[model samples]
Target: MTCPKPRLQALLSAWNAPQRSNAGFSRVPSTLRKLHGTAKCAEEAIDTSTRRHKVIFSGIQPTGIPHLGNYFGALANWVKLQRNAAPEDELLFSVVGWHALTLPQDPKALQQARMDMMALLLAVGIDPKRSIVFHQDHIQNHTELAWILSCITPTGKLRRMTTWKTRLAVSRNANDESEVDDSLLNTGLFTYPVLQAADILAYKATHVPVGDDQQQHLELTRDIAEGFNRAYKTPSRLFPLPEYMTTPSKRILSLKDPSAKMSKSAVDPNSRIVLTDTPAQIKSKIRGATTDSIQGITYDPVARPGTSNLLSILAACTDDDVLEVAKRYHNRNHGDLKADVTEVVEETFRKPRAEFERLRGETEYLTQIAEEGAAKARSRSDATLREVRHRVGLA
Candidate 1:
């Protein structure tokens, strides 16, 4: 009934998102054509960032509720990247259920969460027509590729990754996994990096939009791709190492505890604002948000984390840089700062929340979208996997 956002039409066409133009190609195959400033895609093409077609892949796991941390950290950033992308780019957003299994989950809750996340993606402006949005488990190709890649990936490298506790982002001290004793770390948690590498190389994605926390995982993906290339080359190479396309969004911390990243798993309801929170809930959470007794606003992350987090949230909502937003609040009190942050966040989540509620209950509609997404994803990865098998002498 209504026209899509200008960026939605533009996002699927490019990677690292250059500039959007009028023309866009269809969804891509694994071997995609040259992509520039677009969300379009083709198949049986190489994944290279050097003036060729661009394939951008990013994954989200359905572990629990989708919070602002997930939004600013990954989801919102993906949409931003999509909008600015060249028309030739291919954007693949996967609901990575397999990755969620790294931590134990109740089956029923996890299933609902998967749908909730899918709905949230669409609600937040990921168009099924433009980008390939599918559940990771729906297409077996990801796991198959993961198995092949795991053979080449080293255990030392897996052990070395700092963000292994949570595959997405690290909330604790960057250098310390020592807080959690060694025994609690599961095998899936240990090797999920290999799976993550597989997720990228499966479609031969060129650029991944991620926060700084997952930088090591991206490096590992490139390493595994190089290893696969070294092990098995079809003609010259089978895989083009993907690059990291960093987003401008920063990591949002918890309202209750500024020391940690905002989380869905946090027991306190007021600790993090869910994407689905009502206006009253958002306002209440912001009002109760942990801020220093210190006067006047500043953007010092270390000295004023609570205050800084508020500034970061406001900046992200307004699409302004954190420091620039801080300048606006220099002479203001915490109360004034909170009120504005609350107003903007409520504005930010407004339409998406309403859309999510409408779509979440539409089981048939959701299934249809998932099925189409899976079909598109499978078609793209089929080419890459066949080449992988042939080079490995499995075919």
Candidate 2:
């Protein structure tokens, strides 16, 4: 399965070749110095020659405003990755509009949410000049690749996916899939992982940072890649089976219900702390956060999920160990802990929230960023898609 030249090699070649006269087309820098300053570029974590290139790809749904869970779960990690990424590495952070369509969305609201997500991403330290940041649907190649890959994906494999079941249950407010009828499920919801696979594979991504829950989808991506290689009979595999770069499993639980993960879709507005929440709002939510009436603090998630959740938030905000934070509060009461957590949460979100407010009003700048990012993304992905089409006998 002889694959076409790796995406990075193609990009580097373009970088070195003479500049193109095409409007809006310019060579991307071949070094990390272009993204970050020379002094700030950290020593490459992986040997570049052995690795060739690390294509870091990840995306988030632009369903609505991101919350504390979104920040910590994905956004914060993205910033860290961008900071550490090498010059040769390509980092693609997408506002995945296609994935958001698995569930119903208001068109006008969805359009605005996409813009809001881009502003928040920039405000939170995602450097568009350094990384490719754009809306997923802007590139037609993603869904196009998904359809191609779907030919090799078995219906049974898609049915085995657990997320669809959960989405169905959530749609009807049921406790589990058992309560929701299968007839109501949509094809997009059932095969969401295929599109997710397309998102990663389209870039020929080499590494993806994902939490435990998302691990399953990445595995399925690998399966699809392998299946495609086998079916095509390519001398070298066309798609590189991407590997997971496991991040700290920091699952931010819902403020209202500690048993559940924090989510934008939760019915209760107070269930999560959104990036736009004011300091007063953060304080109010923390103050009302459900904690046990026990006299003292302890870090037992199963026994006292509410209090443990607060301690977890405090530790995450302060970069301290949760157990250590809990030990400090051993002598204090729930109110003291909540107060401290509130202070930390407010302080953590203060700058980003302000920056978001400022960026939101800059419509011209946001549009330029999106247009430039989409161009870069398309340039790379379109090449891969063309190779894919030719190999599959479409071209």
Total clashing pairs in model 1: 34
In angstroms, the error of model 1 at 349 is 0.4
The worst-scoring run of ten residues by lDDT in candidate 2 lies at 22-31
Instruction: Supply the global lDDT for candidate 2.
Output: 0.80
Question: Which structure among the candidates has the greatest TM-score?
Answer: 2
Candidate 2 Cα misplacement greater than 4 A, ranges? 1-49
Please report how far candidate 2 places residue 316 from its true position, in Å. Answer: 0.8
Model 1 TM-score? Answer: 0.84
1-395: candidate 2 lDDT, tens digit per residue: 23323532322232234432312111122222332345333132122224667888999888888899878778877877787777989999999999988888899999888998889999999999899999899999999999999888999988888787888688667875687778888889988899999999899887787877898898789778868876775656677666666554257899999999898778999989998898888989889888898889999999999988988888767655678778878989987788777777776687799999999889889989999999999999999898899889999
What 10-residue stretch in candidate 1 is worst by lDDT? 22-31
lDDT of 1 by residue, 69-117 (tens): 8888888877876776778889999999999898778999999999988
Full-model lDDT, candidate 1: 0.80
Candidate 1: stretches off by over 4 Å: 1-49, 165-181
